[model samples]
Target: MSITDKNLGSKAIQWQAHQNSNSEVPENTMAAMNYAWNLGGIPEIDIRQTADGIIIGIHDATPKRTLSVPEADQDKLISELTFDQIQQWDAGVKFGEQFRNEKVPSLKQILAGLSEHSDRQLYLDFKQVDLEALAALIQEYGVARQIIFAHNNHENCKTVKRLVPEVRTMLWIPARFPETAVETFTHIRQTGFDSLNMVQLHLPDAEEKQSWRYKLQKTFIQEALQYLGEAGMELEVLPYKFDQEDLFELLDMGIRRYAVDEPSVFVELLNRYFN
Candidate 1:
């Protein structure tokens, strides 16, 4: 099915709030997701399972970046820690004084919030988690239709689809070792991934002066639109950083979905220029 068939957003084009609009709130926390939900953007979150098999919303394997972990525990992975142990660290204090006591949230917490808002949609970026447990939890919450299962791993995406066909799946390509749009489309088709709902393309860092090979040019966008369009899969772009020119160019090329750190800014630009 095309993205248009999904209830992700009312707009034909959608802006996915990366890391739950981290520019406004702490990354991968409920606060960030709430902010993104209020802005009518899909809240993209990274999910990992703890040692006890509890799924939590966190990006890194370690809590060092967004959580207040002790120096001694800095190198520890979330998979090695129990849920109770991992939740002790403050998730928001490092971001600002206003967000001092925010605790690490679980996948259940995120899903509970999504269940409240029928219009809300979530982009679940798969990390280290049990797909069966995740799928079961989503089913239990009756949020199977409200979340997008996304991962760089094609097998995971396919597995989730097999587990819950009602849930939409998105496969994201990493920026490292970039592939041509035709090559990407061909691979997706050959591998049977073209049957999925969406395929996300990574836009290289706009300000990067060095990595010319990683840059996604206008021709690449056009080719992606053509080939992916024929394959019946929607293509979404996630940039390393927000760039207005690049975004506008993509809009002109008929690419509508984007995962961005700045959701409010992207919406404003969309309204001013394309709306």
Candidate 2:
């Protein structure tokens, strides 16, 4: 199958409910994943291994900020904590005053809950764990085809390829990178990545800086279109917030994939524009 056929399915909406202030949704919780799945959007979650070798759904290494772990005693690495000790801390209580009662979730529980929706896609962001385990888990669930591994670490991407060659992988770019699209693409190709994932804000830099943004504006959506046309690489643009004009411009430029936090707004935009 073609790369796009393997990577792109329906228009994707990423529910970062783990960071939501009002939802009281714990990061990587079954409740959070279920909420995203129920919204008829794709569920994206961050994964990290606890000290005990159990893969749990958390974004940070320490439980201090998001859990009830004492500040003085929160120095334990995730890889060193057992699941039972990890579960003892309340992740929800520290999730701002709004969501003061959320619970931490295990990756297995989330996957088991998500297994019912065979058609939906999942974007797994590995924070601090071996990609091999993630590959094994995906393979175990027979959902390798429906998941995408995104990471900034090239080694992790390589590891994923070593473990699951058929699984799609994207190189994630931080907002501060100072490379042009050509330079970026060249780097990605050198790293043996299948695609590029970038924030929408990164596209608008001056020529002195990375000119991806200027290029997109000058050619409209044709900038990325031309990139894909020339290099045959998939593009996944992540927009921080829903901006109708920006979304329209991206759609006009031939970008079919987007990463968004608000599914309801994205679905509305999709229905009005693409549907």
TM-scores, all candidates, are 0.88, 0.76
Backbone clash pairs for candidate 1 read none
What are the runs in model 2 whose C-alpha is more than 4 Å off? 1-26, 96-101, 180-182, 190-224, 229-233
lDDT of 1: 0.79
lDDT of 2 by residue, 1-275 (tens): 01121124653434322233323245565556766667665566788887667788777777666678867659777777788887877766564555555567777776675566677667777788766777788777777777777776666766786788766676655444434544555565565444333312234334463423333344533554455556655566655544676676666665766666665566677666644
- Say which candidate scores most in lDDT: 1
What's model 2's overall lDDT? Answer: 0.60
| Candidate that scores best on TM-score | 1
In order, the Cα lDDT scores of the candidates are 0.79, 0.60
**Residues 1-275, model 1: lDDT tens digits:** 11231232444777688884368788888888888777767888899999999999898988878888999998899999999998789999999989988888899988987888788899999989999999999999999899899987778988999998889999887655455544665687677564388988887764466533237665666776676677777789887665566566666667778898877777777765543
